[model samples]
Target: MVDADQTFVIVGGGLAGAKAAETLRAEGFRGRVILISDERDHPYERPPLSKGYLLGAADRDSALVHEAAWYAAHDIELHLGQTVDALDTAGRTVRLGDDGTLVHYDKLLLATGAEPRRLDVPGTGLAGVHHLRRFAHAERLKGVLAALGRDNGHLLIAGAGWIGLEVAAAGRHYGAEVTVVEPAPTPLHGVLGPELGNVFAELHREHGVRFQFGAKLTEIVGQDGLVLAARTEDGEEHPAHAVLAAIGAAPRTALAEAAGLELAPREQGGGIAVDASLRTSDPHVFAAGDVAAFPHPLFGVRLRVEHWANALNGGPAAARAMLGQEVVHDRVPYFFSDQYDLGMEYSGWAPPGAYDQVVIRGDAGKREFIAFWMKDGRVLAGMNVNVWDVTPAIQDLIRGGATVDPDALSDPRVPLDALVP
Candidate 1:
């Protein structure tokens, strides 16, 4: 059933695409593997772009998925600085942007990934306004942070999402005055809800970061082609030397859309709609990472995850599925964030209105606690803040779908494993 004559062409050189290529070889496909990326740099992980790398605590090479020599050694055709301009689903071919070259493939994986959502406010093109989504963007922002720190300048950030907060911490680490503008009542309101979101707000406040909640940035005022201040809808103007638009990211679904693949609606976290095996509507085409919205059997929702863990695991899963292996990507959505002395890992999906109550264990004052979002006594999601080695147990409880007592869930003496059955 396996032959070297077959070729697999993976579009997008991010973690998902790169890992898929590696999995194909590891699975003993012995087929030609080609990976194409629009970015000039080799496939790299994105977490470091905002965390360690932004703070100058880690080097650029640490974020790379593989060494430069690894591709050639593994017989992977690495094509960097090239974009797939078109996808011809019927013909099983893709057109490269650099030239009118058409590459044919027996199977195709679209890991095109996502792009940073740009701010529609004026003065976005002004110098000192930045968005961190790529290695190059991080590289530029690193220098900007250093310069701002040296000058003791002010950094104004829009949106209090993960990127915004992480960069706020990084800016403070660089000794820059950091201020965040958010329309929500608290940080991460959409993800963690106001209850736990307040915890992050307090954490940042203690670290000398300013938060302007219940406000939206109306304009970015600039002078001499440089950011001078940011105006809020509340009629407040904050002096700013630099601005970061960390609102969020939008999936790159243009290629998949053009190919006539089924896509999930924008309201349901827009992405290429894929089955449990990560196969797109077109059987020969598959998708993974931030761009694929697959039905999560555990959560009972069509989920599209944009965190590092998704890309890290989604690629290999999609690869095995392409090889005709039974693959069900039902991994609980998971993500981690480190800001100042606080490190938190969140597992499962628990957006606001979805959970009845949030039960917390440990001390919120000490910033060490595990918060569980429950629906009718069933744990829908769990977030461990400054807690370690309990993710597996928390995931088990969620998968078990058993009613857990709030008192036991909140008791530190009770082992999380015991709550599963």
Candidate 2:
């Protein structure tokens, strides 16, 4: 077992890393904790980047995980703008950036997070093309959006996922003409299924966001080193003064692969493999957040989630495991998103083609409803959209393995708790 006073190193200074440091201290570990961040700034929240901050509803300070003084007061060492060159797992050391600073650790946690995937088609590297991942990226995009609104220019977004939809809302709020091009027929089809995805599509359509559904981007057209339009496979050019690529993200796993740690199989999305306790193949190493692929107790499969709740919960669980504590880390998966006037909270997992039935409570056509995905009368997943004070009831139904009646669930008069037990 590692000693209390030994050094604990956490790579990737994001939400997971920050919370791990906080958990180690709260668990009474009097060890030396060091957090290494690639970005110069400390860890901050990412959700606000697409919603509040991007719309100028919030500021940078509001997104911070903690102020600079908090790190100093907590006696945690913060290394900003530093990259880990290599992980010497056998030697229990990490080689730092170009200077080759070597740091020894009794325990190491890899929360390296994920990087935004770039559009690889032609004319992607031109100016006025942006991808939102970092605070700087959001700041730059906000400026471009302001300019777009002032000139009433067109903003072309290449993806219709959560980020893409949220940015489209922001662009529309700022008076810019917005167009979203999704390869899929509907937005968020992979997660929410077609019925619910259509709700979002209709919502955007009501707000004047044009859709180029079932289309592939052939190229991004630029002139004088700035984006001017995006051409789809149909050979039609859409005017775009600025472009935002929100395709998706890939986990940062170079260090884990180089260290020879096990990775999830190809079918599982290629994340770093870890047990229920978040312990990696190496006894002294552990992983959390977006990079971790752990067994899901409810779904009976390995799952990797990229969202705020997973990182917030997994970090503390991994810290406890590192301290020689027995941990299952079996909390139900949860995530929430805010797009326009719609606020959504989703709990539980229903992998693609896993659920056989969907039951909706309230009026889906009116954009107020709770959707339950079920298999053989048992709830597999539940989503509350534009509905308030119902998440707890939905989560209890999912976790308790309660067989719910479809008629009662659809009835607004039926209390959610009564449908369970």
Candidate 3:
């Protein structure tokens, strides 16, 4: 049994932090668990903020991962809108905002997560330019979409990642002529290979979305309190009434750095360092979610994943580590995205150029396909669009390090049950 009066303090009120709290309770931890958050609302799912929430398909309440009543019933204290000022790791206390009281913690989990990255270009501070990360940011975008009410108004998007493409699709659905600008030759060059990126480029182009591949943002011009257009180094000006910066997210490692914890280079500025057991340099402290770049034994490298699946799975692993459980938690890295009536799913871990064989489970022509990643005859990762039921099965196969015939797996007649161990 755990200490009755022990306190567990969790930073961030996103899925990772909330799941850590839930996992702690599920493991019979009856101690006081206080969840600190800078947002006004409780924990919520973030993936839908860019698509469903912006399109009016999902609401504020629906975005939340868990009900508020559930937290209250579980006796989980919420310090909403409380910004963590500092962390006294040696003292085992977290310093909060000016008025907020300092919290004492026996075990601290740093699930502080990440924030939307912004451009440093001129006119970026203009009224219409925005980046989506929190609920408030999405609300602002939704409001702009409602007020403008103009289809064909140029909406220029920076970056060509999944979120940027989703926003471009939404703008197209709203009848706005959208243009995507990326410094990379192809979209999602870091995750999906060039071939898949080419497919996405074609798909978006077919829907009337324009692409400025290999274009870089130089300046965001503003006039009289409104953004007018942005320029590229090539002296090209793209007229845009509004701009959505979807470059990427930077992990919130300010507190960790201030606390003098070990840090490592991530895709962004930095990600916190953690062992296979998910413990930081200071064993009493642990980090998870986007902030934690775990050392992946299977992938043979450390990875910082920013996905709902990762937050949900890693959160529990961090808690389990604190509870003295030995867990590798190197499960298949899975993620999903919902766009324009299309359900997309990604399962397992496929490093750059690691796959030698590509297996197609369904028909791509039918807009239903699952492309399995097989490296050295082992299934590493997959891309499943409109075919997500096999995600869990693929995840298990990857975890178990099992291999199957590529031809047999690709056939549409193959069952997910047969793919299982």
Candidate 4:
């Protein structure tokens, strides 16, 4: 029922953009589909970059979203190593960065994603300094870790966030000495709070990873264009053959900003502001993945999720919306992580101060427990550590928005489904 002359354009080459393109084709859209990416490689999932791939357990090809031949077979105009420099919202066109080629689009999806926040301290440009955001960064870090392992070198990590902690585990697995410098009192204090964050601290500490808590890296000392050590605010100098700045990532919103798109404020986890259907201020444009901040009907707050699950699911939702489907992107926020022997899956959003009292079910010492963040006797978020197959039940409890006794919630004997109204 659609015009074959119409075209749908996607601006990113990451998982979200790739999945959007796939969804457009799957939704029976026969119009011209143009997918542009700045990276030369095919779109790939990023979880393995810091997980299996960095640990040398998964191969590079395992990360690809689809086979190289799939794009051509599906008749997708795959433009790799291409950047969109200018977005002409008035003209419904985008200008290519390399050759200034202008491409028209009936509808545009902005999945520009995010970039790692660089460490601003001096000596960051020295050799052996690293930031793991892209495939190439992971490749280089893998080599650096291997060399450090063989040569007995030290690795100084700047933050205690997920990336820093995961890379710390990988470095230890490689037999390299690892030290993490964190500005918070405990690792992941912002996300898990100090209570649960201590669990991760102990996990890493058991594996020989040292933590310098409540300190920031003021300088990265180097000599002869190579890293030598990192000096923190506490005046402690840590010897380092390599340094990783795993502080965080900022959304890539330059293209959207230049196009006069509405952006969420800095406090709302800043990104391109989109509605429940992922439609931007301009009706002809939409957004998804890390670059899109949309209001969540469930959480009742505007959220910009940087996790893999958001990208994996948001892309297709935006695609369907673009194709005139009635879509509401209100899926509960979800993410997972693996470090050393501990693995965890978290659902819903319950940052510190948002919920009161965290109730734990099972034994924390054994690392097999489900922690629930509750407010007014209702579950706001749930994280199952070393627990299996209860994500559905946990999510149901959150979605049902029912209040239950804290004693029953903390009792393993009680079934999670029964708690949901």
Highest lDDT against the true fold, candidate: 4
Residue-wise C-alpha lDDT for candidate 3, range 10-48, written one tens digit per residue:
999999999989998899988999999999988998987
Q: Is candidate 1 or candidate 3 better by TM-score?
A: 1
lDDT tens per residue, model 2, 377-416 = 9998999998989888888898888678899999999999
TM-score of each: 0.99, 0.98, 0.94, 0.99
Between candidates 1 and 2, the one scoring higher on lDDT is 1
lDDT of candidate 3 vs native?
0.83
Task: Give residue 161's lDDT in candidate 2 (0 to 100).
Answer: 92
Q: What TM-score does candidate 3 reach?
A: 0.94
What does the lDDT come to for candidate 2?
A: 0.91
User: lDDT for each of the candidates?
Assistant: 0.93, 0.91, 0.83, 0.95
**Can you tell me which runs of candidate 2 are displaced by over 4 Å?**
none
Candidate 4: where is the Cα deviation over 4 Å?
A: none
Per-residue lDDT of 1-421 in model 4, one digit per residue for the tens? 4578899999999999999999998989999999999999999999999999999999999999999999999999999999999999999999999999999999999999999999999998998899998999999999999999999999999999999999999999999999999999999888898779999999999999999999999999999999999999879999999999999999999999989999999899999999999999999999999999999998899999999999999999999999999999998899999999999999999988899889999999889999999999999999999999999999999998989799999999999988889
What's the CA error at residue 413 for candidate 2, in Å?
0.9
lDDT of 3 at 73: 87
Model 1 residue 319 CA deviation in Å: 0.2
lDDT of 1 by residue, 78-197 (tens): 999998989999999999988879999999999999998999978899988999999889989988888889999999999999999999999999999999999999999999998899
Candidates 3 and 4: which is better by TM-score? 4
- Give the root-mean-square deviation of each candidate in angstroms: 0.8, 1.2, 2.1, 0.7
Which candidate do you rate higher for lDDT, 2 or 4?
A: 4
